[model samples]
Target: MNFVHNITAIFIFAPFLAFIILLFLSRKKLKRGAIGFSADITTFLLFLSVPVSVEALWGVNISFAVSVTAILMAMILLVLEWKKTKEIEILKYVRKTWRLYFLLLAAGYVIIWLTGLALTVISF
Candidate 1:
């Protein structure tokens, strides 16, 4: 059971790890896309696996409100950064695609939260 919990923890965190890699480390287009997609799928799986109980897993609580707030804040920062770095014309595209990007981030957070809860349950 510990092993399973460990594996699940890894699965839950994989997307966040990938997001960091894509956001900061990756340069190649293919690599970035692959990491992003992996993060999305892993997050989706985590959301699907959430248990019914409300508890903190690995010191992180899973809350929909928190997830939404995080996503909105992140998107705001990203948009601000994009506007600063890119031309106004390019910012339009960023604005259009921003929702999708935030949605993915939110999904990832939700998965992380759920996975944490699942691991906590498994540990007990």
Candidate 2:
């Protein structure tokens, strides 16, 4: 049981571990990009899932705020990158690869959150 718990903890912390590893191994820009992207997706989900109770996890609100800010900053960087790249086809490819996942994840989170909210409201 202890071993199982330890494994689960490691699994849960793997992303953070990976971020640390990337920080040490990758260029500063690459590490920032990866971390910023992950933060955006995480915050988007948190914002979508906000509930009206103190019983819920406390960190969600903080994470939601940080994520939203990170996403906005990332968007600014993305625009700058696009302008600097100067190649239309390459810019399109970069946009699709880098942003598509965040867009889809945000959409999915919104859909699930809306559905859940509707169900709760209807039930009440």
Candidate 3:
């Protein structure tokens, strides 16, 4: 049990490992081999960041913050798509949503890491 927990912790903290693993799986099996896999990786990284934010004293309701951001992004995209084509294609909407999520999460991950690092250093 402890071993499993340690492994999970490693993945949570070092998400590059997850990205590499995803790259391999996508190339070897899925054969898509594009940047599509990054969306999943960043999503995991962002959601996992809630705990890190709490530890860094920057978040009391980090989960809610993340959720609301994602919802707002989707709504904005949905509105723009509707205006452009007078329709919302579900597949395209879904794809754009996740890709946008990937960018947002990646940015948030960097900011959160920097904030946490700064706070920790200042405390010491």
Candidate 4:
């Protein structure tokens, strides 16, 4: 249990490592390995962002903040899709939502890392 907990903590702290590992591990098994593991990588990044934000003094319980943001974006995208196409396609919308959510979380994580570095350097 402790080993699993520690491994989880390490992955959350260094998420790129997890992504790299996944890419390599999946490459042989998956035809489009890197793309195939995107959702999994996004999840690792989302979890990473929550802790990074908290440590950077950006927000508390940031997973809730991001989850709401992702859902809101998904709803807005779905509405736009409905308006443009005159119908809602669940599977397509879900893929778009996943990509959107991944981009959002990745950007947030980078911002948090920069802010954390700045905080450390300036003692603020």
Instruction: Select the stronger candidate by lDDT from 1 and 4.
Output: 4
Residue 17: error of model 1 in Å?
Answer: 13
When sorted by lDDT, best at the front, the candidate numbers are 3, 4, 1, 2
Q: Local error of candidate 2 at 95, Å?
A: 6.1
What are the Cα lDDT values of the candidates? Answer: 0.54, 0.50, 0.74, 0.72
| Residue 113's lDDT in candidate 3 | 77
Please identify which of the two predictions, 1 or 2, would achieve the higher TM-score against the true structure: 1
TM-score, one value per model: 0.32, 0.30, 0.78, 0.82
- Candidate 2 contains a number of clashing pairs equal to 0
Better of 3 and 4 by TM-score: 4
Residues 22-123, candidate 2: write the lDDT tens digits. 445554666557655554444333343332121132323344554576577667767776798765466565555346545544554455456766768998
Total clashing pairs for each candidate: 0, 0, 0, 0
RMSD of each: 9.1, 11.7, 2.5, 2.4
CA-RMSD of model 1: 9.1
> After superposing candidate 4, which stretches have Cα over 4 Å from the reference?
44-48, 55-59
lDDT of 4 by residue, 82-113 (tens): 99999778987787777776666667677877
Q: What is the lDDT of residue 82 in candidate 2?
A: 72
